[model samples]
Target: MPVLVFGSVNADLVFALPVLPAPGETVLAPGYATLPGGKGANQAVAAAQDGAPTAFAGAVGDDALAEVALRGLREAGVELGRLAWVPEPTGCAAIAVDRAGRNLILGGSGANQSARAAQVEDAALNPDTVLVLQREVPAAENAALILRARARGARILLNLAPAGEVAPEALRALDLLVANEHEAAWLAGQLGCGADAASLHRALGVGVAVTLGEAGAAAATAAGPLRVPAFPVRAVDTTGAGDAWCGVLAAALDRGLPLDAAMRRASAAAAIACTRPGATMPRAAETAALLG
Candidate 1:
């Protein structure tokens, strides 16, 4: 089985500071680094590092920063045959992390917004394929991809981050939907449903996983609800935790792990990612050790 990530790739500018700057207040960062990231790229790297056969489809600009975004993905063994080169500048994210490990992010869409639907559908989707998606790209493109994947019987896993409208066809096609607490609430409102995992699942008629940050994560399913406690770890930078979770979960599922076991493994991976400085992911052995 293969996991295909149809998402964005970005060159991340990370600023480590004592505290997040207040409005109209300037704060000097103590450390800074440029890293490869983007919800899609991060997830693809996470899945590949976790020992899954992963492929990534997206666009990057023809610029120096583009190499920064592709390096980590290639290092993690993700196939990038579908990544497109466009005229726009590469997408970027300016991230500020405080001593408490919380972060504030501002994104430059650039090439991400320029991604085409054809690039995503270029992959050979099938029943054994898992299509990982996020909101960083255009929703309409995602919607079209969902339809194409569904028609081919590929499993669809959607992460509704930075929540917004999803086409009804795409919503109904999802095999699983992952969201944080705030995103869950926003999705529920958008779907005209109650603001809870169960209601959202019922409304969308799919499995729903709600990430509760430090508290943990819960999922609503046909069998019933499942909950996994967050692994206790010292926080360093929480920038890519959710993306780690989404990627690991998709990998676990593609490897034939049961849903509960997959969620637990994903939780551990996310916790480990929280202990790192950027969107870096652990190797398969490291993640397995954390699961134990």
Candidate 2:
């Protein structure tokens, strides 16, 4: 089985600032690092490293950034057939992080924002493939991929990061909704999604996992809300931790593991990811060590 990711690819410019600038303030970062990032790419790398048969579906511009992006995924063992090519400047994310884990992300949609619905609809979707999606692409286009994948009987897990307005029609197609709490709250408000966390699960008609940073996470399902505690670790760069969780979750589910176990394994993967710098996701062996 393959975990197929449908989302953006970006060249990341990360800056370490003493403190984030206020809305109207100007500040300078002491140092910087260029990394291979973007939620889709990060999760794809995470899935592949954590033992999913992974494939990535998205666009990259024909530029140096594109080469960097492709090289990273190929090295991570993700399939490339579904990737599209455009000249619109591959997406880029500028991240400003303070001494605390707080971060502000400014992104250029680049080629990803222009990813078309027609392209997604025309692509072959397999029943056993777990279609993973994010909000970096247009909502309509993301919805189209989910619907098409569902039609082919593929499992759908959507990570609505950088959340935005989503319609009811699209919500029904999402098999699982994964996002941080703030993103979940914003989604619920914008879509009139559900009254509360419990209601949100019923309304969406899918499994809902709301990540709570150090508080761990909570999942809403038929049984009720189940809270999963965070793994204890000395945090390093928290940059790719969430993506690592998503990646491991997708891999575990695709491999026929049950939900609770999957989340725990994902939590472990994320804990390990936070211990590394520059979005370096743990390989299968590394994650397994944590599981041990």
Candidate 3:
């Protein structure tokens, strides 16, 4: 089965500093770098690197940064046949990382906002496909993808990051929902459900995974609730950790691993992601090393 990611692609600018800036505060950075990022792009790279046959469908600008994003995806062996070239600049993220490995980010939607409802095609979907989606693209576009995938019987994995109002139709179409702590709480409030993974799963009639950072993750599966512990690792930068987990989890599940085993691989991949800077995804060998 192929994992198809429909999300944003961005060029991430990272500044490493001694401390994070406060409101109206200025900080000096001793290190800087640029990397390929975006919730969709990072997950696509992570999935491909984690040994999944992955494809990415998103928009990028006709700019140098687009080349960077494309390079990263290609290097990770992600199929790019469905990627769109738009007139706007590639999406961008400015990240500030403190010595503690915590980060603050500001994103510019740029060409991501150009993803349209018409971009979805039936030809790209099938029952064997795992459709990976995120909120980085326009809501209507995401909804259209969900509808198309649902009609084709493709399993939908929706990563509701930076969450807000989601269309009920889209919500109902999801087979799985992955969210971080904050996003999960907000989503629960919106749906009038309790702030637990099991409650959310029961309310939405879907598998729910709520990531609790260092506390690891909790999931409500058809079998029952499960908790996976976070792997211990020295932190460098936590950027894209969630993307790593989501992508690896999707790939592992597509390979027919049970949810518990899949989440273990996802946890290992995420732990490795924290040891690197930017949105760098570990290769299969690297994750294997971590798992050992």
Candidate 4:
């Protein structure tokens, strides 16, 4: 089954600093690097690069930026038949990372907010598809996409990042709720759960994977909580690690790997992503080496 991704695309304008500045303070950086980023686009690239049956359904502006976004997706092997063009400028993110992996970000909605209701209705959905979502798009659009996917009988796999107002019903509807520890805590609170595995599982109905960076990942399942350790690697840039993990996991599941084994491969792929600069994940050869 294919994984259908619906979300945002943004040009990541990154600044590297020796130390990030405090609020109301200033810092200096030597140079800047620009990359195609946005949770949805990054995850789609990850999925396609890892050889998932993947398609991206979203809007990008009818501008030069949009062309670049499209090129990136095409290079990653994501199906772009459903992507549409909007009138607004392309979305953009300003990112600052210190010597450490910590980052500060400021973003603009741009074309992401311009996705129309008609386009939402026209999303080509399939019953057996894995519907992956992220918070980079408008909240209403996200909800609308979820509703449409549900109508089309797709299984939802939501990765809640950059937090937004998601209803508890949405939580219950997901076949997989993938998140980092902090997002898990926030999700637990949103659903009135106690931020523990048991409560989180009860609220989301038992198929939730909580990722804890180097500590690894834990999932809440009917068979009980399952934990997987992270693959150790010398970390370089953690920019797109989470997106890589989410995409690779979705791909592995689509390829029929058992859930635990899928997480291991996902973790290993993410570790490889950390060793490389920028958000693009390692090629198929590198991923195969890690899997081997």
- What's the lDDT for residue 240 in model 3? 82
Clashes of 4: 0
Number of clashes recorded per candidate: 0, 0, 0, 0
- Cα shift from native, residue 161, model 3 (Å): 0.7
lDDT of each: 0.91, 0.81, 0.89, 0.79
Better of 2 and 3 by lDDT: 3
Ordered list by lDDT, greatest first:
1, 3, 2, 4
CA deviation > 4 Å runs, candidate 3: none
Clashing pairs in model 2, backbone N/Cα/C closer than 3 A: none
lDDT of 1 at 178: 95
Best by lDDT: 1
Q: Could you tell me the lDDT of residue 101 within candidate 1?
A: 95
- Candidate 2 lDDT over 1-292, as tens digits, reads 3798888888888887778889999879767888888888999999998888898888988888887666668899898777889879999888887776567789998989877655544345777778888888888888777777777888888887877865567677777788887888887787577634576797777788888879887788776677778888877678888899998999999899877888888888998988776577899898888888
Q: Higher-TM-score candidate among 1 and 4?
A: 1
lDDT value, candidate 1, whole model: 0.91
Return the TM-score for each candidate structure.
0.98, 0.92, 0.97, 0.92
